[model samples]
Target: MFFKEVVASLYAWDLLDENVDHALDVLQRETRTNSTYLVALMHDEKRPLTDFYYPHNPRRKVYWTEDSRAYWRPSPDGYERIKPRLSDSDELAGTDWMQVLIDASRARGMSVGAELSHTWIDKERTRTELADCVQRDVYGNPFDGQVCFNNPDVRAYAKALYVDLAANYDIDYVMTCVRGFNPGRGEGADTELGRLVGTTHGGCFCDSCQARAEAHGVDWAALTERLRWLADGYDRFNHKQNFELRLLLASTANITSLLVELPELYAFLKFRADSLTEFFAEVRTAVKDVSPRTDLRLNHYAGHPELMGLDLRSVAKQLDSIRSSDYAEQSGDPARMEWKRGYLHNIRRTVGLDMYFLSAVSPRPKATPELVEQGVRISAECGADALTIGHYDGSWLDCLRAVKSGLDKVGIEIRPDLPMWQRAAPALDGNPPHEIVPSSRS
Candidate 1:
C-alpha cells in the first residue's frame, strides 16, 4: 500500500471545501499515493500558521489549529468510561473528518484506515476530569500525555473506540501508536542504566497492573525493587565525575552484572511485553467481532519497541502490519540507514509481518527532496512491503513529488488513480541481506 499521513486541518483550509472528491484527487495527483490516513485526534500541541513553502491555491489557507482535541465527533454509543474532548473550532464545527474520509474513500472504492495515538490525550482535562485514567511510574507519580493502558476504564475506552470505528465506519484498518517510556535527561540518557530502568516509563504500577503481574506469576515486589535500584544507579551515574570512563562498562559489565544479580528484571520485561500483547489481543478480538475484515496495525517505534512493552516477535501475531518511520532524513545522518535497514529486515525475518516504512518529507533545510527520495529508495531496498509518507502539508509538494522519482529509481510503478486493494503489492517473503540483531533488554 502507498499511504500518506494527511492533516485534517488541511480540509478546513479549503482543501476539501471544493468537495472531498476533489481534495482526495488533488492528494492522489500530488503524492501518487493510493491510500491516506489521519490521526483520530490532534496530537500536535501547536502547529504553524503557514508551512515553510507557499500555497499554490490562493483560496486555501495553509495552517493547523493548535488544539489537542479529537478531529472526529464521538459517537453517543461509542464512549462510556472515558471520553475525548472533540474539537469545537468554528471552522470544524460541522465537518467530521473521519466521516468525510470514509465517505470519500468508499466513493473511490478505497479502504479507509483509522489511526489512534493511545498516549496522546488532553492533558489539562485529564488532570481533572479523567485523573483516574492517568498513567503512573514505578515511583507512583502520575504523568500526563499517557493514560494507564492497564486501567480497566482506559482499556474499555480504547476498545470501544476501535469497535465503534469498525462497526460504524467502513474502515479496513485500525492503526495504533503507543509510545515508549521516557529514559532520563535527554542529553545523558544514552547510558545503559537509563534503559535498564525504562520499564518504569509511564509505568502502570497501579493496583490493577500490580495484581495482574502477580496473577501472571511475576514477583511484583522484587521487580519494583530492581527498577528502583536501577533508577537510583542511573541518577548516581549521571552525577559521577568519571562518567566518560564509566560509559565503556555501562553497556557491558555494568548491565551484565545487574542483569545477573536481578533476574526479576527479565521477568518484569516479559510481563510488560505480555501485558501489551494481551491488550492488543483483546482489541483485535473485539474489532474482529464487530467487523471481521478490519485488520490491526501498529505504529511501532523501531528504535526501542521493548521500552513500550512491545516485543514485536511476541505481538506480531495480533497485528497485520507494522509501520515505523525511517530516521535517515530526519536526523540527516546517513549511518541511521544501517539501523533502519536492520529494523525493517528484522521485523520481516523475526515477526513475519508486512512492514510499512514511513518517511518524513518536509520542514526544510533538514529534509530535502533528495533526502526524502533516498529514504524511499532505502525502504524499497530493505524490502518494505509498503510506503507511508508522514504528514502532507502545502510546503511538502516538492518532497512529495520526489517520492515518485524515488519509486521510479527503485523500479516500482505507481497508479495513484487505483484503490490500494487493487494496486498494493504482496508482502515480501524473506529478510534482506543482514543478520538479525538482538533487541536489547538492558
Candidate 2:
C-alpha cells in the first residue's frame, strides 16, 4: 500500500469529544497539500492517558505509592481499587480512547495507525514478584521499571497486548517504539561514576542475558570477570584521587586498554542486537496473525541502530515503514544538515527502496512558518517518503500551512479536495512521483 506523503501524530489524550471537530478542522486546514495519516498513541506502557483497554488475566488494579510510583495490584476480591495517580476530576471514564480517536480520524477520511512501546512496564508493578521482569544492568541491578526482552513471559505478555490491539482496533498500521534493551539516556551512564562503571564492565549480566549470550558462543563468564576487574580497579582509584581526574584517567584506560583488549565486547553488542531482533520477530508474527494486511512500522532513533541493537536490514522485511525524528531545528548549521542528509541516505541504503521512510519534524523552541518550510524541504531533499509534523497540540496552524507550501514547491500532491468520507479507498499500490529515491552520493 502507498504511504501517506504527510502524516501527523496526535496524543490520544488530546482527542476529546468536545474538541474532535475542531482538531479535525485544524488537520484538514493545515494538511492542505496532501492526504494525511494519523498515528495515535494506543497502548502506553508507562503512564497511560486512559484506562487499561485490554482485560487483565488476574484482574489487576492500579496503585500509586507515596513516592509517586505507579503499579498494578492484583484484585482477587474484585473490590473497587483506588487509582491515586488519576485525579477524581479527570473525566475520561468509560471512554474507549483508541476506538474514539480512530473513528474520528477515519470519519475525516484519514488512514489511522497506533503506536506502542514494549520496554517500559509500570515501576510499581515491576516491584511485585508477579511482574518482576525488569532488565538488569551490568551490576545486576534492574533498570528502573523496564522489562527484559529475554524473558519469555514478558515477551508473551507484549505479544498478547499487540495481538489484542490488532484484533480490536480497526486501524491501518502499528508503530512500535522503544522496543530495545538499551538503558535510558539519564541512566547512570550520564554521570561520572556511571560512565566509569559502564566503560569497565559490560553490564546487563542477568541470568537470561547470560544464557542467551552463552548460546551465541560468547564467553560470558570470562568477559564478566574481565569487566569486573576493570571496574574494581576504577573503584579503587576513585577513592584515592580527585574524582574528576580519576574519571579522566579511568576513561582513558577503558578506551585505550579495556575495549581494545576485550574482543568479547563486540560479540556482546551483537548479541544484544540479535536479542532485540528475536523480540521484534515475535511482535511481527503477532501483528500478522491478527491481520496480514496491517502494516508494521518502527519509531526508529535517528542513528545508532547498532547501539540500540537494531539491525535494520535484517528487520526491514518484517516492517512496512520506519518513522524517524528529524528534529530539523538542529539542522540549522551546515555540518548538522550534512550529517542529517547522510543519515537519511544511510537509512535508505539500509532499508532498501520498498519500505517507506517518514521523517518527523519537531516545532519546538521556534515554530515559525519559515522553519516549518525548511524542515519539509530538508526532509524531502534528504529522500523521505513522507514527513510528519509532530505533536499537533502545540503546533501552529500557520506553520502547518507552511508545510503544505513547502511540499507544493517539491511537486508533491495535496489531496485537500478529496471527500471527507469514502465508501471505497483508491488503489495504494503505485508509487507517487515524489517517492524517495536513493541519493547518488550514497
Candidate 3:
C-alpha cells in the first residue's frame, strides 16, 4: 500500500507521431501507470538507434533530439535574472511540446511532470557567455559537460529554470537530473585502480570552487597538490612495463592509504556534497515560492553517492521524491538482493519523503521482464511510494505487462484512466488489441 504513483518517463520524440491521443492511450494501457514525466529538455548523446522502440512509420526517419535545448519556450517572467545559456531545439522549436503533453495528459485524467538534466547545457553558448560556470580540473581545464554547482550564476540559472517550468505549466512535479562529477574518470585512465589510488578527476577547482573551499575551511592548495601528484603517478604507471598487472594488483587498501595520506580529500568530498545539497535547497525554495503545488524530485544516476559528493540523506530532505537507478540490483546479481531490498525502505524511513526507484525495461545488460517484476515486488516490499519506468518508448510490451502482473501479485490494481470507447484502438493483425502503432502524416 506504500505505492502512491506509477510514472512513465516518456521521451519527446515518442509523441511526434501524429496520434497524440492514441499514443497516451497506448501508454496507459500498456504501462498501467497513472502518471507520466515527459523529458522536455535534452537527450543523451550516447543513445544508439536500438534504444528507440517507437515503432516508426515507413516515411519517418529514425532520429532523436541530439541538442541540449529546452523543448518549450520560456515566458516573459522566466530567465529574467540569469541566462541558462540554453538553445532552442531545431527539430521541435515552436512545437510547444510541454503544453501539448499537458493537454493530452489532461484528457486521459493523468498527471504530467517534467525533468531537467543539470549537465545538459548548450556547450557552445556557455563557452562564450559563462565559461567560468563549467566544471574544471585541478589544472583549471574545463570539463565538457557539467556546470559547477558552486558557481553563483549556475545556481541562479537552475532555480530560474525550475521556477519557469512551475510558473509556466500545469505540471505536477519537477525533477533535477544530475550526473554530478565522474570521480572514476581518472583523467584519461578510467579504471577502478585509478579511483582507489585517488587519481580520478575530482574537480571544479575553478575560482568559485577555490573561494568556496577557503570559506568552508578546506585547504584548496593542499588538495590540488595531492591531486596533481596522483595524476603524475598515474601517468608514470601507465608508461611503465606491465601496467595492467600493476593495476590489477591494487586494492581497497590503496583507498585507505590514500585517504590517510591526503585527508583533505574528505573535506573536498564533503564540500562537493554540501554544495549540491545547498543547491537543491535553494531550487526547492525557489520552485515552492513560485508554485507551491508543484513537487520537486532528484534523479541522480550514479552509485556510491558519497564518492560522487551527493549526500542522499541530506539531499532527500529537500525533495518531494527521488528517482535513483543505483541500488536497484538492475545488474541482476542474486548476491546483492538484500542491498536492493533495503534501499527504498531505509530512505523512506530516514528521510520521510517519497522514493521512486527507476526500473529500466530495456534490452539485455539493462533489464528483462522477470527482473522488472522482481524490481516492482522489491519496491513495494521496501515501502517505496512510487515506481518510475525509465521510458515508455524504450520499453517493450512484455516488460510493461510484467509491471502490471507484479503489481497484481502485490494486491495493487491499475485501472486505465481512459474511457472504454477511448481506451485503445484495434490492434494490428498480429499485435494485441492494446498495442498501438503511429499514424501517417503525409
Candidate 4:
C-alpha cells in the first residue's frame, strides 16, 4: 500500500535527445533522494509532443507523420493511413521512451507512471473527428478546441486511448489531466475580454449536449433562448455609451435573475456534472479491464469544482487518487504555506478522506530555495499522501534539491549519498503554535 512520497512530472521532449542516458542518470540520482515516482508524459493530445503508442483503430483513424506532424488521409474503400510520430534524430528515431523509463525505473528501484491528457484534441490534425465534440458557448461559438464530454465519439476515443496505455505500458499508475469543462480565460481574468467571455457563459450547448439534456428531462430550447438573450444583452451594452458600467450591470442582473428564476440552469449544471462522471466512470472501467492492478488518478483544478463539473464526492469510488496543482507563485495575499493548506482543505472536503490526495507544486521563476522548502513542508503538514513537483527540466534542479532538504527536515528518509546536515536546529518552545484556518467556498 506504499505510494510514492515524492513524484516528478517530466516532459517527453526533454528526454528525446541524444543525452537521454545523462538525463536518466540525473533523474535516477534525484529520485533516489526520496524514492520519487517518475510520471512521464506519454501522450499529449493537446500539443501532440510525443508519438502515439497504440495501434491505429480503423474506425477511429487519425494519422501523424514521422516528425510528429498530424494529418488526415482517407481512401475510397473506407480505409485510412496511419503512422507513428517518430523523432527525426537517428539516435531517437526508433527509441521508445516508455520502455526506456520502465527499464530505468526498475533498475533504480523507483516507480514509474504515465501521464495523459483527456478531452483535448489537435484542431488542425483531427478537425474532422472533433467537429461534433467541440464545446460551444452561449453565443454559439466554439470554445477553442476542447472536446465536449457528452460527445459519444470523443468519449469512445478517450476510452480506447486509455485502454491502449493501460494494456501496453508496464506502469504503476495512470494519471490523467484536463478531464473537465473549460473554466474560461487562460490569463487569469487580467483582460476585459477574458472576464466577459469566462464569467458569463457556462458552456457546451452543442447538439450532443442538447440531446443529452433533453434526455434528462431538461428544456433545452428554453435554456438556449435565455442564454442567447443574456449574450445579446451583453453585446448591446458593450457598444453603447457608459459601456463598461452598462455591461457590468447587465451581466450582474442577468446572472442573478437566471439563477433565481431559472430551475433549468441548475438542471443543466447537474447534467454537465453527471456527464463528466459517466465519462470518467467509463474510462475507469476501461483501464481496469485492460490492467486491473494499475491505479487510476485524476488531476483537476484545485478551486472551482462547480465550474469544472467535478462532483468529487460522486466520483470518489471510481478513482484511486486525486491531484490538484498548488501554484505557490499565484498565492496573492496569503503566505504560500497558508495557501497550500487552504487548497488541501478544499480537496479533502470535496473528495473526503477515503482516497489518496496529492499536492502538485509549481515553482515560479522568482521562487527561492526557502520558498520551495516552505511549500513542501506545508504539503506534509496538511496531510498530503504524496507531493509532486510540477515538472523536471534543467531549470528545476535547485528546487528539487530544496524539496529534498525540506523532506529531510521532517525525518523522511533520503539517499545516503545526499546526506542531511549532521546538526539540526533545535525546536523552538514557549511560542504560540500556528493555527490553521478552515477554507471557505464562499
**Top of the candidates by lDDT:** 3
What are the models' TM-scores? Answer: 0.80, 0.73, 0.80, 0.74
The CA lDDT at 358 in model 1 is 37
RMSD of 4: 12.0
- Rank candidates, lDDT, best first: 3, 1, 4, 2
Local accuracy by lDDT, each model? 0.60, 0.55, 0.62, 0.56
The C-alpha stretches of model 2 lying farther than 4 A from their native spots are 1-3, 33-89, 183-203, 230-260, 330-336, 414-442
Residues 122-168, candidate 1: write the lDDT tens digits: 77866887777776767877777677666788778888878877788
Q: Which pairs of residues clash in candidate 1, taking residues 3 or more apart in a chain or in different chains?
A: none
What is the per-residue lDDT of model 3 for residues 255-322, given as tens digits with 9 covering 90 to 100? 56655555665556667777777777777778877887787877756545565667777776667666
lDDT of 2 by residue, 203-321 (tens): 35678877766665567777666555545543555463335435555473553353355555545555666676667677777767677777677888635565455677766655777
The alpha-carbon RMSD values of the candidates against the true structure, listed in the order shown, are: 6.6, 10.7, 12.6, 12.0
Which has the better lDDT: candidate 1, or candidate 3? 3
Error of 3 at 334 (Å): 7.1
Pairs that collide in candidate 4 are none
Name the weakest run of 10 consecutive residues (lDDT summed) in model 1: 430-439
Ranked by TM-score, top first: 3, 1, 4, 2
